[model samples]
Target: MAQSDTVVRILDTAEALFAEKGFAETSLRAITSRAKVNLAAVNYHFGSKKALIQAVFARYLDPFCEEFNQELAILEKKSEVSLEELLEVLARCTISVPATKGSLSVFMRLLGLAYTQAQGHMRRYLQEHYGQTFLRFTNLLKLSSADLPDAERFWRIHFMLGAVVFTMSSLDALRDIALSDYDEKTRIADLVARLLPVVTAAMQAPVPEQPELVKQ
Candidate 1:
């Protein structure tokens, strides 16, 4: 296989494996076996197992973040924008990533894995790479709610992130439960539509004042 094809295969296999089995459990041997590449190919391309894991995440996040930033730039160019408008763009950008069926869900599952399981170099690599994307989004939220205190803005954004990450990670289970209990057809495409309103609401939720603690 061509060098580029080999690299792509390794990344794809690694991502699938990482999503299926946690990153700590998936091994280089398994990735190479699934990709049909030899051990030397992995080392040649990625240098080490941790680097390979980072690359697997970058393969998805780099493009997604790029597209998201492009959309954000367009929104910035507008005369006016709202929290809801910016968040709607965020939701649409993710759902619009071109891939085979269920690919987005796989990406989300991998993303959740990175948050809860990744450590050391693996976690730091992602934070270093994607940190700006997150910062940009938070800045936009700040712009959207300039009147709010810094603490309020921070808490609201944190809640929004929690909502998005949890919802994406639990999509399958949520769909099954909804289907069984309510006869609801919660298709993947429907997720962005459902998620937008909920996330937006969280971002706009009223921040309560801290009550003073009495002296002990």
Candidate 2:
């Protein structure tokens, strides 16, 4: 087999094993055996076990972030970046783009594991490297909601983001509940459209008009 193909195989096996098991539970020998590669291949391509895990994550995470930024850039060029545009970009980049069945599920399961189980270098690597995407995204949100106070902005974005992420992970369940009429393939786009307005409403609340004082 070609070296690149070997590398890809190793990554695929590692992602599945790591997700189903975990960092401590998974071992390099198991990954290599599953991939049909030797220990040398894993060492050659990924350098170490921790690096291999990071590579598996980057395999999915990198492209997703790039697509996100690309979509945002296009929107920013077309017009002012509204909360609507932000929501749409997120829905499209995140929930809608997984081409194959079960890809999103695999990613979500693995990602959920990473949050709870992975640690030390693994956790730090994800936060320092992959987490940059959110840092950049938050700046855009700041631009979109300049009027919101610091505390309000922080919590609002927090709640909105948590809703979006968790929902994407459980989208199959969500469709059964909220959108029984649609298939999973179609549901993502529809969900994005339907939730966009509701989230926007949550973002907006009545701002009290300054009371006019009678002249003394």
Candidate 3:
């Protein structure tokens, strides 16, 4: 195989295995075996397991961040961007990014694992590489909800990510249920359409008053 083909094969195998088994659980040997390449190839291309994991995410996120940043730039040119518009742009850009078949669920599953799994290196790597895009998105979110306190906004942003990760990670299962139980065929776009309003409403919910602590 050509060097580029070798790298692509390794990445594709690594991505699927990582999504299925998580970064910590999936071994480099397993990835090499699945990709039909030797251990040397993996080391040559990615150097280490952590780097391999980062490479897997880069395939998906690089394009996503590029599209997201462009959309945010366009929105920034407007007088003001509404909370709903910001979220809609996010959804559109996410869905519009070109990905291989069945890779969307894989991408979301790996994302969920990134948060749920205890991989400090992966977290730090993501922060170092993609933190700027995340910060820009968070800044826009803050601006859109200027009325909310900073602490509240922080929690809401995490809550939104939690909802997205949970829902998209189980997308295939949800689609199966929708088709079987309701006799409805749902596309990813349709699911995002249903999800955006709920996410927006949750983000826009009134801040609850803090209750006084009772004496022990």
By descending TM-score, how would the candidates be arranged?
3, 1, 2
User: What is the lDDT for 206 in model 1?
Assistant: 71
Among all windows of 10 consecutive residues in model 3, the one with the lowest summed lDDT is: 1-10
Tell me the whole-model lDDT of each prediction, alpha carbons only.
0.81, 0.74, 0.89
Candidates in descending lDDT order: 3, 1, 2
lDDT of 1 by residue, 6-95 (tens): 888888898889889988899999999999999999999899988988877776687789899998788768776898888888887787
Position 64, candidate 3: lDDT: 95
For TM-score, the strongest prediction is: 3
Model with the higher TM-score, candidate 1 or 3: 3
lDDT (10s digit) by residue, model 2, range 66-183: 8987776676575467877777677678765543665675677667666577467767887788677776677777777778876787778766755665666676677676545543
Kindly report which residue stretches of model 2 are placed more than 4 angstroms away from their true locations once superposed. 1-3, 75-79, 95-99, 118-120, 172-186, 198-216
lDDT of predicted model 3: 0.89
